[model samples]
Target: MKRPTPADACEVSTMGKMEKVPTGIPGFDEAIGGGFTPGTVVLVAGNPGSGKTTFAAKFVYEGAKRFGEPGVYISLHEPREEFYMYMKDLGMDFRELEERRVFKYIELLPPLGTESIDVLADKLVKAVVSLNAKRVVIDSITPFIRELGEAKARTLIRNVLKTISKGLGAVTLLIAELPYGAQVIGLGIEEFMVDAVVVLYQRRGKAWTIPVRYLEIRKMRGRPVEQVVYQFVIGPPEGFTVLNPVPLEVRANVDYRELLKTYISELDEVLGGGLYRGSVTLLQGHVGTGKTLLSLIIAAENAMRGKKVLYISFEEPTEQLQQTLETLSYPVDKLRPYLQILFVDPKSITPSAIVSKFVRRDTLPDLVIFDGISSIRRVIGRELYVHTIRDLCKILKAYGITTIFTTDEKPGKDPAVSAIADNIIWLRFRKVKRGLVRTLMVLKNKLRWSDPIEYLLYFSDRKLHLRKLEV
Candidate 1:
């Protein structure tokens, strides 16, 4: 029996009952639910240097090259040569498409638009009709609004939506810029008139803070799109591709304990059969608490067992991580072949980017560690950290790999990373009546119940031991 489609699923897409356009961007299509629906106008908005023009133009180029759909890019800012040249740097091969007649360009500035473009909406509409173009990209609609005010921009966008989408059956993308701190809602008209509205935003700071690229769909005329913070990075030739996101299934039942096991066996045993294989484990504590040391033990042990291990350090350099491991007398020299120590300080190449580097499911490592969690707290915040960790646990669990992470918990504020872990182990300084000693505690356990809520943990001259202590 044919099942009825849910009412909410209607605006999620308009590509027929089961049709989907495969533009082939790495992860972009999936975030917006799927590719653009036929007869849909998608607005791509972003700040300057946010790769706005580069991303939109490239999408149209892909439609021409991959799907064999003829495309046209209308530039409101630069002339044809400049527009084509600008994208060339980002690796868009528009010249070849133009030669093949599969692509064309039209610049609508005063010089190219002889008559006023605002009053000549038909001229722009005619170009798309004559080219028989199925894909159209207007470089930017911000300046084009110069000739037309808010009311006129609204009417013009409405007309363009009707002509290209309904008349020409074209999948058009309108580009616009967004000012910071201000909620620019696609001229408010484009959002209502278009089938899909995609917003591109730029954020600056450290590498982690250096926002790669983010896309949000405010409206999808009638189609489904996932609402997730996607790492949208457009590499040289490919243009815009989202990082491989964690599959939906992994988010719910990730086993964090099993991942803890791949790091340290004793810790695993204490953790009761290791972290839940698919759950995220947050290892956070105070300063000088040996978070980094704990990670080394997990990495070296996993490598000794012939399982691959990856240790990423944001605060500590690679050389520093290795030097610190030597103090633990870890068998780092033995499993050097199987262990991978990646030193990444840049913010843009985030935890999610690690997923892009580990696609080889055929031989995925058995254990992964994000050593010293506190240091990375600011790089990828608590909220995003949860999402990334949730997705990470699912992917690692699907491959049966274990992961261990460490974070710093301030004195009073609860640790931000604790909730996501399957098992949470903490290390902090505790002063006993006799002396001040570093303590380790089983704050939370998603794996199995553990006895002795708190324990006296001490490490001296390469030896680590724990003793039962009063909480």
Candidate 2:
């Protein structure tokens, strides 16, 4: 073949510099600015069982299968047959790939005495060139270094990288084994020779809880990595995949901002014109003090306004709530279209169940009323109840859904619910000459410009009367 001229050589180098060698692992390529640079040597360093081999295999397999670039996988410890069967188990189908001449698996054992390191390096380069391979993976170089000493091993690796970069121009992955507690990476010197270094580690989370697999890009030549540490999982049928980072803010997909009316003028007036969208209101009162009644009234009024409402009852059964609404003269027939009633036995409900139902509902509601959180707090332990209530409020608020939670007041107030609630309303009944007199008190209102005060609560002729504002 005739040697190319200076202009042709410049064009070729420019093209090679512009292109990237993408790894098939999801989120990995994006972390390294689309992929590895062409003709670059990448060192994947990890402890035993840290998914080093699986990652290298997936990298080459994806190149062959998706990018139409042939690859060679050279192993020193893993046998050729075992490597084939193992990759097959992971759905790589390396046998078929080999048959199609897209993949080549080679195993070279240690004690390479008779043959010189330069000769072996030449043989590997020839294999890549002969097969027209564009990608290569060696799992790994530790055993080879053990057989050829550090100095000779370093020289041999430099020659191999030169052969691939200058002769074949193939992107290569060199796996390096590090001891469990080794401070240095991959014989310590290879880091300087390679263009990139990635470490797979088992990182313990939250007070040394069980470890999770994580990938850290320690160095990437000429590329900037946004997130250094990324969570990854190695499972069969997909091989190795890097997981995306968790979202910083949980945003609602549908952005609804209008407040659903509670239909109580004075109550709504004290609540900054109306209850704000995505606000959680806690209704606390003793038995017969109208906590449940207030929740039902809000739900009924919101539903009557053509807004979808989900009413969850822990105390009253669905039939009993319907009958009570009928006795209270609420238009149950008109409200049925816009309301969904779910009667859950508090003992049978768990935090997970409530979160799933609220987050994954088929028809998401504009407003939700959890009538009788006291029962939930009692059934689920206090700690679990607090956690679940907090999570539920977060999900509801994130989804822009107005929430009403009713709980019976105890002698000493529990700050658990109030801490997460955006609005707090307290109901109390005082005995007087005219039977029992009910009063409503506003303890907290997160809405802008809302007056927090107490008022006499009187209900008659399907309307609520807030009279004699005090305190």
Candidate 3:
């Protein structure tokens, strides 16, 4: 399956006769459905350290640097020298633009004892016209209007922003600072006043390990938006990057017989000559039904055949897995060349964390084996657990990787893992007249017709043996 990029999934309607202006920021244009309308007033509001300043600066710098449009950055809180160094650290050379006369900086200090809203608006409008600036950013409108009260502040933004936006035909970004944990964005009137309102904040991702920055398009007037909450990251080179959810389309190409050859002949026969390539096989039974041993057998065989295999065990350590394989008469040293064993503590594992680690690997394996997957269910919730398993299966199968997962389930009780598995091999211990006996049964097989017969399974010569029961 090919994953759809942000460019492919976000297709906004171009029916309206609105002239769109590109933000020059990657993945941001898609959020606003192909950028903002020209000469629009946008409010970038958020708490301190929520990337409000950087967001506004990036827009300004991008417009002046890449889009051939001069911009004005009005600083009310930070010094010009400090702001120059800050933007430079973020890989934006604002000093160069200023030298070329393509960018301007307006500094309006506080103590506006009698300066009315109209006065500030007049200064901003003059700056834009003097520089012929197409883009303008007010570093912050919070302190500037705090003394005016919410009612007066609302009037100031409503009057001032409309004047600048319409007077000079410039796209303006007003930076607003809301107190931490504030319920509303700005004075709650900014959303109504501005043509677009975007809020930036930090949210704990699915894992809750690190706080992820998110940009929310609360309101984009007169434009169709595809996403509301977008995950973003601010770092060097590219100041901001959005982690968009790409839709996956899976297409499988496999030879069922060739895939099944990775297993021993005994297990392969019961699996309709071989397991289907790209099929998720689940081995379910009680604790001591040789589930780990079986999963290792399949992994070890494939590794010895020069196929790459990745084995992940949540229950045991890597040393323990290696010692056990050695004790089982398998050549652990030779097998190490093609196999990689990873032991993840189920207590500390998250679906997003683990999946990200897997996909980001330099190379992918031909087979993925998960032993003791039942522990994952105990750590992650049912919904997330199922989602993790299905996501891994789909991603691996899309690359033609065979998957085998093991779990311990009670009799007649279908576990959630069964839903994602394409084949289910149930092993259990039964008490017969001859004492305790181990048997293998097929609960489901998508490849071919499987007879409902319990086969006798035993260990002989340090290898697994499977055969039909004598009548």
Candidate 4:
């Protein structure tokens, strides 16, 4: 190659600065300084469904379509057919690209807990050199590490990233799935070796409350990226789409006082005139503890009073809910004229996805009740259960929606329930010295104080009524 003149060198440098590639992922290219700089390494880490593979495919797809840059996808976990199966639903044509000699797909068979990292590195290098790849993706960095063992794997990861950058001269997209809630910046030797890191997380909430989806990215090479979290989702036509953040005003400051007033007059007075506008009240008790009945009373009464309300009943089916409420003297028909009830059956939708899709943009209800928060929670898993509740509270409070949640407790034991709810409404049936009786107690109210401490509530004549406790 001949050395260029000063003018030619200047032109080359300017063009290099102007050259940009779309990563095929939404919000990702923008996060990585217009696109990966030539020979830069980007580490993308997430739990499953975090779009690790799909994101890499997007990068390859955009390289071909936008820059006419040939790319390669190396798979260690699955074969080429498997890659196609996962990407096909997302409108990817990897097989066609392979046939056209524009893109190459390679799969390596590495044992999960017993693979040699040095051998792995050799395979990676050979693939890059042969393809003359301009862009590259490693579908997963997991199996390689698992096979090589922990300490040795770290060394291999570092060397692979360093060698790839120096010899291949390609922008690298390394796919990784870390355990839940792990830090994004450091992953063995690879963390320190990468130029940028992005962590994607999914949050959830009770009933119609929408969980805002976003990601956190840490730039190691001074990439132009905003620190603010941005909403994202995996949808059709566009695989990963990013949405604008919800305006602060639209998400918070509810009126609990009005909500309490809207309920039965005595219940309102018992609750010190009203619950705050934007507050979360949890109904806690054991099975058959009147959780559904209490929700029915609130939903039916509010609906009857011309207030918009949404009821997501997890334990009871729609018809089953109607029949049970009818048996308890709360008929949906009698209350139909006063209020509107929208049932979000959990059988079809996950609680977290519901909040992201429905709670944020749908009807701004005066009250929203997630009958039995435990049902939605069972799907979130044990590790993330606490954080899930906290995020839910934030989203609901921002929307200013008077929210209520139900927790079915075990008999005679209060197991860390207060940590999750803003207000704890404990409903119990206990045998006192006098006799066996039902009890409803307002235990913890985050917004304000209440005086009526305990009240005797009744379900009679197809209606829920209240009376002062006979002590």
Candidate 5:
């Protein structure tokens, strides 16, 4: 679809408001002013695998399942059995809804002639009337538009789709397919005929490998669309979920003098007592500089003190991390209750998805150890990486959660993160006559002046120890 312009904004303001029907997609209804306006034809257009079918199906399923609204799904292509199975995998069991008599699925074979358009429209109207459906989906209108040409297609939409919407008072989602690399939504005529238009896009990142999905509300007749674009994901349990990156407005009334101790005495001493409450800390270092271990020690120690700690690891799995804790003589069993380890694959998930999940949580953790943020940076690219980190830090600090983000980058490399950080700890390896020795230094401290001296770091008897480094 085309980007909305000034003229489009003016058009939206003049339209009168109507009753809204929620689509049941998470984080989506709120984006579109509580949901789709009733008695309107909405065009859901996208390239193949961009989730047009999923979006339409969800609109129908949710109406039937949650709102007790009867719905009808008319498919010009995909068979009934295949559609049922595919939707079932996404946790939408159309069969069950069909059995309840609240849902109807109709499949029509194509090579649809000019005469067949009337017949198809008649069947759709009959289905809606029979079921007294409140929602309808035509998946899709592309074949009809291509076969019948623009003039005939326009007549079909205006005569049938709009008639069903206005007369029957059902919200209709007309699915349309845009060929790969094509920008226009369904030959251009369908867009004007529809009341609203939503475009789904599967865009590649900077590496051009991972696919990032986005949903853009190109046109909404009655409602004022504040944010046009949103990142979304489609999976099981819930069909489609929008990941809203809008930072929450939270005021954390915290005393800078109050400290959250890590219980590592030497490290605490170096930290000017302990980490300031509601402050963000960045631990930067090269690979194998003991960044992970140090962050884990802080997480585990705080958890042992009955504080909830969320350890988000992008690189390491839970079992591997538990083993490391055991190797360090940490009580893994004892730490399990208070320490919640979440392992996320950077490739499969988008940064917005991760942040959205955190935003939905009922209770925020006392401490969050985000291990290996560099992996996320690599997958999402630099621009998105910076944006996601900035938003995440803002949310965490707003909740007054002391967060520690570990990355495999040297100090001053990522000024964006460093600027957001309240404290920066640089860890590195010093190669001397005795071989490589691990060392730690406080690069920046917002609450107090950082000590200039570097310190030797080592582990003994399952505890980390630190001392002044002497040449």
Candidate 6:
């Protein structure tokens, strides 16, 4: 297992002749110009439980498992067995790599003086040489800097780590412990010494109620840092995954004149026969105005027509939605084959992540219904919410997927959201002689002229009924 030379580690790029070694983290390589340049030292700094260790381990494990590039992990804090067990839980079987003689884990306990730093460096070099490792991670250099002072630690990094990176042609990921809520990354000097710096944050902010994990690339040598911050999650099966922003491009090469009928004859007539194949429709109304029911009806209608429909409810659970369908007399068992229902908790995921998961798919659905999208706006804030929805609609439109978004009507709402939709249907309740009656109005329609007329909407015999109301 001879270590790859600098040339072997290099991957040619269009921007220049620089060589890159992919980190093998999903959605992360693209943010860093394909991957890290060969023989570059990357400093990963983060507070405890911010996934610094997990990120480092994944880098090493991925190199060994996917790239056939051997790796060595030297831990100054974590024990070997515990680290292996934890990594195994995350789907990284380091033991198998070790058995293949391509991976090694060396743990050095603390209580070390200045001399021990040299011994640690020697051990790392020896391990890399023995296994011909191309990836190395030091799970953390914080203790050394704390114990030996910044001056000695700087000397060690410059002489040892950089040498191993350049001389051995191995990419080095040096982990640094950042105190909670601290602005500085790992004693502040580590960033200047490394070729790249990635900071992980676990903190509560305006974006989410719970502590959201974020990955920020403060610096990356020779790479365009177009996006500085990204939401990340560390979970099983995949240790570290970054939620890259979804690319918004209208690439649907479909006929915009084509229409997909909603199966509601009167509503379709009001909507100029049907919705355009690649158009976005907004179903805005106050609560209890049958927004969910109407969206479900559209979804069921499409599903019954043998069209693939995806219904994502941010407010209702899958079981609750199924119950609603049963109560509405919709054939749940029959519609199950074509209609895919998913319940997402707005608090559990970021807006970008949600859009990325559903929109960036290989085979998109024919129609998508987002029920209770107001919850999403509340969770991700206004600006991001608008951007996410705009990008999402663009992606769906490009796939020729008819999308219906249901949001609660509220005062002071940003018009940018409604402006993005190709068509807008405003649902409200009007006081009639017989209590309150539900009304539907087509405020805007891009495909055809929509008369400013309100329709009385109601359900009878499990069927939706609509009638023109004289103004």
lDDT of each: 0.66, 0.75, 0.76, 0.64, 0.84, 0.82
Evaluate model 4: give its lDDT.
0.64
TM-score of each: 0.67, 0.55, 0.62, 0.53, 0.86, 0.86
lDDT of 1 by residue, 351-455 (tens): 656565543334566567876555455676767666665666666655555567776764336443455566677788888788787777777776567874677
Name the candidate, 2 or 5, with the larger lDDT value. Answer: 5
Error of 3 at 203 (Å): 7.1
Task: Report clash pairs, candidate 5.
Answer: none
Better structure of 1 and 6 per TM-score: 6
Backbone clashes counted, model 3: 2
Model 5 scores a TM of: 0.86
Question: How well does candidate 4 score on lDDT at residue 11?
Answer: 12
Predict model 1's lDDT versus the native: 0.66
Summarize candidate 3's per-residue lDDT along 335-372 as a digit string, tens digits.
Answer: 98899898988666446445544443456677889898
lDDT of 4 by residue, 201-245 (tens): 666544334443557776647545668675576655555554433
lDDT of 5 by residue, 251-314 (tens): 5434486789988899899888999877999999999999999998999889889998999999
User: Where does model 4 exceed 4 Å of error?
Assistant: 1-51, 57-194, 197-219, 223-252, 256-262, 272-274, 303-319, 325-366, 374-387, 410-422, 430-437, 444-449
**Cα lDDT for residue 329, model 2?**
83
Q: Give the winner by lDDT: 3 or 6.
A: 6
lDDT of 2: 0.75
In candidate 3, position 279 carries an lDDT of 79
Q: Which sections of candidate 6 miss by over 4 Å? A: 1-16, 84-102, 236-238, 245-257, 329-337, 359-362, 379-384, 398-400, 410-413
How many pairs of residues collide in each model? 33, 0, 2, 16, 0, 1
- Summing lDDT over every window of 10 consecutive residues in candidate 2, give the lowest-scoring window: 3-12
